[model samples]
Target: MPKTIDDLSTPCLLIEKERLEANCRQMQARARAEGVALRPHTKTHKMLSLAALQKSHGARGITVAKVGEAEVFAAAGFDDICIAYTVVGAEKSARIAALAPGISFCIDSLEGARQASAVFAGLGRTVRVLLEIDAGYGRCGRTWDDPSLVTFARHVADLPGLALGGILTHEGNAYQPHQAATVMAEARDRMLSVAVRLGDAGLATRGRFVISVGSTPSANVFRNAHRDGFSITEIRPGNYVFNDLTQVNLGVCSFKQCALTVLTTVVSQHRGAGGAVRFFLDAGRKVLTSDRAPLSDTYGQLLYHARTMAPHPHARLTNLSEEHGWGAVRGGSTLTVGDRVRIVPNHACVVVNTQDEAYLVDGDEVLNTWRVDARGHVQ
Candidate 1:
């Protein structure tokens, strides 16, 4: 039998069901108002039930960062999927071709496009592909204005077993600024400009130009971007489903809306010189990923007091090692060992990647246990 939320072990990840559904509805309505299809990236939750909630709210499809993730979602009955990463390698190509019958993938290189075409040809299937453009992220995508972009698109179109779906880009660089509104505006403009330029070159035909842009920061600012000129058929935003401390710090979301949290138990408490107090939690880098990006400084944030549901205004996580998180409480609040607390992780995606399953919670009640189906599919 599954354990209830209150009876479950400490230092477990929990998702507030109501908050998650609310966030989904908000994103879905925003995308609908902009007349763009909401194809949320499933890399955030990686749960079949959550993906179904997204689809139920009128999402066009789900987006994934890896072929393995796509396979996971496809097996869960999510047929229409977009592999947002650059398709490469003979092994990966074969896997992609195998999925082509049920899913679509993004291609950023001529070699990858050709390989996909050749592989799909043997199966008598034409794989649908999206040309990934470099929207100043300097990541895996090709330069949007590069003259070779047109040639590559033409090459993919000419391939017998390949269908050019459109262009895609991840405006991940926007997150660097740490300002949600500014990053969002910049992302939308950068992505839309690339789409317009491609359309002007006659590369977009029969309205097949699908301008897809994603990144949690970018999605937050999408409302400001002009919607008419660009053929932005889809908007893929995944992190909105489970807002984390990073999103909260970036101003993308508030603390109340954060649906996912790591519940931990206080293992130790001590008083230091000058009457300062320190508290330690059993949850550490092993459970909460230590992979901090450039702008982030800490592993996670403390959610005030988990027991009383009281907001901790000045509480902060001081340090973290392999298996311990040292917290310093500013105010004179008595904390004892065995006290339970909730931590807002710095990066929810990384936290999810580290766990095999998460608890579905409703105000102290554990409703169900959902597997992190796509966890550890790093390849």
Candidate 2:
């Protein structure tokens, strides 16, 4: 027998459907106003239903971080997808070639381009390849000023079975800023400048040169700064779908709009010295992610019941082990065991990895459940 929303087990992930729909619409509207295609990254939710909702809200396509993720989405009917990772190795290259007829993959090194070209040679099909540029994030991308970048692009263009699809970058460093506005402006400028440089090198004139940029903190800035000649045709942000404690601490979103939360039952309550009340919950790093950025310390944020769904100002998560979370309630108020509480994780992506399925809830009512099909696809 399948379990409905309400009859499920505790210490589970719950997603508010209405809030998720609102977030999808908000990003879609912003993409429309900016005249850029929204290709939201599916690594956040990893659920086909949410991806469909994004498409219905005017998204051109979706983005995935790994080949397995792309396969999962493609099997779910997302054909026009982009795998935003550097292609390498024969196994991955074969998978990329197999997916070439339906989706696109990114390339950053000459060796990867050559491998991709060799793998797709016999099908008479040209794989759409995007030259990844190193923005502020020092991740896997060729440096913008690397003299060999144009040579590599030309090499990829000259290849018999490959088509240079333009440049892509993830400005992930923007999340470290003290203010959202400043980070957004800098990330937008960096991406736009790279796109212009790629165009100046005659990359866009060949065909549909997709200049993709993304990261939730930077998407808002890109939307405001869109213009012609920059060639920024797509944006691929993932975390916007389920805002988390890190985003809230960094001022990216508020607590109310957060869609994902882990519902845990209070297992124990004891008294500490100096008349302090200690509360322990069954949820810990195993349920809530411990992947906190520089902004937050605890594994997740504790939500206390009030008049509505507001987080209690004095409620805070003080410590966390593998399977236990400890916290202190202000004023030493007593809390009985078996009480239910909701915890907002520090990082939504990591939380998605922790659960195999999540409940779709609306207000206080449970709606349905969806499998996290693309979990653990780290490659």
Best by lDDT: 1
Clashing pairs in 2: none
lDDT tens per residue, model 1, 297-364: 55677766674444466666778887888888777546689888888888888888878889988878
- The alpha-carbon lDDT assigned to residue 173 of candidate 2 equals 78
TM-score of each: 0.92, 0.93
What's the C-alpha lDDT at position 373 in model 1?
Answer: 89
Off by over 4 Å in 2: 1-6, 224-228, 273-275
| Best by the TM-score measure | 2
Report the C-alpha lDDT of model 2 over 285-325, residue by residue, as the tens digit.
78775677556666677777411467766666788788888
lDDT of 1: 0.79
lDDT of each: 0.79, 0.78
How many backbone clashes can be found in candidate 2?
0
